[model samples]
Target: MSIPLDSPALALRAALHAALVADAALLALLGGPRIHDVPPAEADFPFVALGEAVVADWSTATEAGTEHALTLHVFSRSGGRAEAYAVAEAVAHALHDAPLALAGHRLANLRATTAEVRRESDGRTFHALVRFRAVTEPL
Candidate 1:
């Protein structure tokens, strides 16, 4: 079935972006509020970018809801994986079980599911992939 025009996933994403940008802990790790849906070609190192998001129907007999599998990418050129991992920890601490306000949906639950940090193919850049799982119900 086709998804509704006013999708909860969109609302959830907006909320996530706002929350991440406003989180002081996460911002400090990045040296600024460098959170973006798509980073520019010259974006500074040690920044967080919104990555993939997979949405699925999670409706009950009487309730409409959604399940979101979201990924946030952390990029850094710092000497080692330490910086990337630190940023990932801040991201997880800010989001896990946090109450977020969405436009037309209520966040039922949000949790940091997984995080992985590794050196990219370039061999200099460190990449941290932080994944989150969230459930939202339309308001």
Candidate 2:
């Protein structure tokens, strides 16, 4: 199937969301696949969320390319930062170097950029933000 020239980013987002949710390590942290871009009010801890994607059209006459800036958020309410940090590490492992089969596109590279684990103002919840850079080329 051909992907719409303007919609490749949708395929890339879906591929990435699936990859993170299907990862064993990530599931172990959350007890099930609970990744989301927008979490519910009663969302559980240790969950992974795909915050946003900034995609730039990088195309040449022969091929189409996209440079993506992706952000992931990990939430936890454990006694300490261990649980949250562990989940963040698993996320990094799952995404970095992943060979995602993006529809109508070829994954050129995916790498973790930065991550920070800190307790929220409430001092009860931990928020971890992980950033990544991805490049995709049309197949």
Candidate 3:
């Protein structure tokens, strides 16, 4: 079942979306990727996508309340800086758009700090820590 847009979950999703949209360089990096699918699971939120040469899996903590973390994983046929940034951008945008459903959730605060970009044999990956404060009242 989907939670109401006013729920805390929706608030968190919105904060994530804002964070991704705020970064242009990140967006450019993650361009031309297709959103494969999103699965419903506890603990981690996953968005799967297919890039030019790789498949990326971005997972983040979807816990309700305050202080959450997000991780992006890139799996590619070849590894490069451009590929890494692209994956990061896509993941960021996904998070930014995540909260579009929450209309009534009040965004008390949102802060995206602590960003890390890494390169591996598979591809490049970016990790970000997103902190937000929101409140949802019963109707």
Candidate 4:
């Protein structure tokens, strides 16, 4: 059955964890040799390692159906926007190629709405607000 976005805390947490794992795996697959290591503190973003990840909020609407919003907090330790955007593009590509099985859920489709990069205070760190839709066959 389809579970409402606000259905339960445990379910949401489980979904978030699964998504995180899938994201990490995708990044690893793309980063290849560059995939050095992911720090613990970097989990604050949606796609960590080359960047961090965070699930801001999600909700279900009758008009649009189901939607999930997330932010990728990328830290350009090297202080380069190009590098950060490249990392973001890699993440977007990975997410676009991610399969439902990878998410451990029967997702009908996943679409990336936006992937713009923004600068933080230090200018070395950037944040990418990657919004996407996750369609599933019921729950």
lDDT of each: 0.92, 0.87, 0.38, 0.48
lDDT winner: 1
Give the per-residue lDDT digits (tens) of candidate 2, residues 9-103: 78778888899888987897799998986898889777888887888887788877889898889999998899888998999999899999988
Model 3 lDDT at residue 3: 49
Q: Write the per-residue lDDT of candidate 4 for residues 1-139, one digit (tens) a residue.
A: 5745543322333453455455654456334323323556544333344333333234356422233444443445435566666666755665653564422334446666677777888765675555555554334
Per-prediction TM-score: 0.95, 0.88, 0.38, 0.54
Candidate 2 off by > 4 Å? 1-6, 60-62
* Best candidate, TM-score: 1
Clashing pairs in 4: 1-139, 44-53, 45-52, 45-53, 45-54, 46-53, 46-54, 48-51
lDDT, model 2: 0.87
Which ranking of candidates, highest lDDT first? 1, 2, 4, 3
Candidate 1 residues 1-139, lDDT tens each?
A: 7866678877888888999989988888899999989899999989999999999889999998889999999999999999999999999898999899989889999999999998999999999999999999988
Show model 3 residue runs off by greater than 4 Å.
1-6, 18-28, 32-78, 82-102, 120-139
Over 4 Å off in model 1, which ranges? 1-5
Model 3 TM-score, 2 decimals: 0.38
Clashes of each: 0, 0, 10, 8
TM-score of 1: 0.95
